[model samples]
Structure formats: C-alpha cells, structure tokens
Target: MGLFSKDIKTMDDLFVHQLRDVYYAERQILASLPKMIDKATSPTLKQGLESHRLETETHVKRLEQVFEMHGAEAKAIKCPAINGILEEADDIVGDVDDKQVLDAAIVAAAQAVEHYEIARYGTLIAWAKELGRADCAAVLEQTLREEKAADDKLSAVALGEINRKAA
Candidate 1:
C-alpha cells in the first residue's frame, strides 16, 4: 500500500508498514552485497562488504523475529527508496572504468545503502517504542548499531585508502 493509504489508519499500522518497508530494503541489500563485494578492488573494502553481508543475513532474521513479536505478518512490501538507491549505485559503478575508482564508487554506494538503512531502523525503533513495543525496539536497536558501524567502516575505508587511490 502507498504510504498515505487509508489502510494505515493508526500508529500501529504505520509501524507495521515501516517494518515491511525495512524488511524489503534489508533483503535487497543482502542480494546486492555480493556484486559489490566482487567489484571492490580493495581487500579491506571487499572483506568489510562480505562481513556485512553475513550481518545482513542476521538482520533479516531479526526483522522476522520482530514481526512475530509484534504479531504482524512476516512479509515485505516494495520499498522504492531502497530500489532507487541500489539502481543508482549500479549505474554509478558501471560508469566508472578504473578499478580503484570503482572501489571508491562501491564504497560510496554502500554508504548510501547503509545510511538509508540507518534511517529506516532508527525510525522503526522509535515507532516501536511509541507503540509500547520496547521489545521490538530493542531488537531493532541491535541492527541500528550494526548499520552505523558499517557506515563508519565505509567512511574509514574511503578516507584511509579508496579515495586516495582513486584520486
């Protein structure tokens, strides 16, 4: 359903809708990571992407658990925001010729994804608590910390080496 659809008549409904949104986003990130990993020329970047791919798997599972805990169906709705971000990443990565530059592009793309996720998870956590589901918030908080860490690692990789080599 669209964000403004009458189907979300209450805060709880809104929370569930956002939950599904992030669910779809996390799955998309999971699918896209392998390609990013392969495209990365830097060993540190590649290893970080791979490691986060594993974490992304756990993120999906945790989202499912949150769904069950919140008594909502464990399903995903189309998240256009994530789709657009991933598509833009692909476009940018494909346009770059230099492998080192491509690694930098990949890091930038991955950071975009991480930033998107961080926003979604942060909002979800707040909504969960507002809905009196601190349990769900707590679960989502774990993923938020991971997402933030992933973003930080991407920044470190970019500033420390990738951007320099690309330059």
Candidate 2:
C-alpha cells in the first residue's frame, strides 16, 4: 500500500507501515554493503563497512522483534526512497575512477544511507512511544544510536583522511 493509502486507518497502522518500510530499507542496505566494501580501497573504510554490515544484520532481527512485539507479521514493503538512494550511489561509485575519490564516494554514499536510517528509526521510536509501546521504542532507540555512531564514524573517516587523500 502507498504511504497515504486507505489501508492505513490509524496511528498503529501508520507505525507498522513505516516499520516495514525501514525494514525493507535495512535489508537493501545489508545486501548493498558488500558491494560498497569491495569497492572501498581503504582498509579502515572496508573494515567499518564490514562491521556495519554485521550490525545491519542485528538491525533486521531487531526489526523483526519489533514486529512480533507489536503482533504484526514481519514483512517488507518496497521502499522507493532507499532504492533511489542506492541507485544513485551505485551510479556515482561506478563513475569515479580514482581510488581515493572512489573511497570518498563510498563514504558519502554510506553516510547518505545512514542518515536516511537515522530519520526512520527516530520516527519509529517516536511512533512506538505514541502507541504506548515503550518496549518497541527502546529497541528502536538502540538502532538509532548505532546509526548515528556509524554516521559519525563515516564523518571522521572522511575528514581524517579520505577527503584529504582524494584531494
């Protein structure tokens, strides 16, 4: 169902829809990270992406837990926003020839994904709280903090060396 589709008739429905949306996005990112890791030339960047890949696995499971906690079937709906972002990332990464520049591109792309996730998780937490599901919100909050840390790590890698080396 579309975001504004009539299928969503209440706040709970909206929350579950969004949960499925981010669930799909997280799965997509989990699949895409290996490609990004392979494309990355920097050891630090590769290791970081690899670590986040494993973390993303936990995220998917956590989302499943949230689904179970809410008594909703765990399923993923296609998230066009994440698809577009990943497509654009693939295009840009493929276009770059320089290794350093490519590493920079990867960091930028990864950060874009992270930022998208942060927004989704943050919203999910708020909605979970609104729905009186503090348990679900607390679980989502862990993912949000991890997403933010991943973003910050990307920023550090970019500023600490990647961008300068690319330049």
Candidate 3:
C-alpha cells in the first residue's frame, strides 16, 4: 500500500511502511553503488563507496532481522525519493567530462544519499521506541550511527581534496 493508504491505520503500520521504503531504497543503492564505484575518479571516494556498499549489505540483513522480530517477511515498497536521487547522480556523472570534477560530483551525490538514509533511520529509531520496540530501536540506532559516519566521511573527502581538485 502507498503512504497514507488505508492499509496504514496505526503508528506501527506507518513504521513498517517506512521501513519497507528504506529497505527498497537500500536495495536500489546496492544496485547503483557498483556503477558509482566504477565511475569515481578518486581513490578515496571509490574506497569509501565500496566500504559503504558492504555496510549496506549488512543493513539489508539487519532490516530483515527487524522484519522477523516484527512478525513480517522482508519486503520493499517503492521509494521514488531515492530513485530520484540516484537518477540525479547518474545525470550529473553523465554530464561531467572532467575526472576531478566528476569525483566532486560523486561525493555530492553520495552525501545526498547518506542524508536521506540518516533522516529515515533517525525517524525509524524514534518510532520504534514510541512503539515500545526497544529491540528494534537499538538495532536501527546502530544503522543510524553508521549512516552518519558515512556522511561524515563523504564530507571529509569532499572538503579535504575533491572539491579543491575539481576547482
């Protein structure tokens, strides 16, 4: 069911829906990251993306655990927001001819994804707590921390060298 659909009648329903949303988004990122890794001109950015891609795999498994704890099978709903972000990244990469500038663009695109994940996981943690699912909250909190770390790393790579090199 779509967001705000009749299928979502309680906070728990809302939480599950969002969880599914991010689940799908993470899967999409998994599919898209290899291309980003290949396109990246900076060693640091490529390495960071590779690491995050591995982490994303763990995240998907954790999400599956969460679903099992909640008495549901792991499933995904479409997340157009993430699709849009990934598409924008592809467009930016396609348009850029300079490797250095492309590296900067890749960093920016990655940060966009991290920011989206941060928002989703942060909210999921809060909702899990409100729903009295401390177990889920703790697990989601771990993912949230990882997302933040990933974002910070992207920022550092961007400001430390990529941006300057692009300029």
Query: Which RMSD values do the candidates have, in order?
Result: 0.5, 0.4, 0.6
| Cα-based lDDT for every prediction | 0.96, 0.98, 0.94
- TM-score of model 1 (CA atoms): 0.99
Give the number of the best model, judged by lDDT. 2
Clashing residue pairs in candidate 1 (N, C-alpha, C atoms within 3 angstroms)? none
Clashing pairs in 2: none
- Backbone clash total for model 1 is 0
Per-model TM-score on C-alpha atoms: 0.99, 0.99, 0.98
lDDT of 3 by residue, 1-167 (tens): 77879999999999999999999999999999999999998999999999999999999989999999987769999999999999999999899999999999999899999999999999999999999999999999999999999999999999999999999
lDDT of 1 by residue, 1-167 (tens): 99999899999999999999999999999999999998888999999999999999999999999999999999999999999999999999999999999999999999999999999999999999899999999999999999999999999999999999999
Residue 51, candidate 2: alpha-carbon lDDT: 96
The TM-score leader among the candidates is 2
Q: Tens digit of lDDT per residue, candidate 2, span 2-88?
A: 999999999999999999999999999999999999999999999999999999999999999999999999999999999999999
Q: List where candidate 1 sits over 4 angstroms from the true fold.
A: none
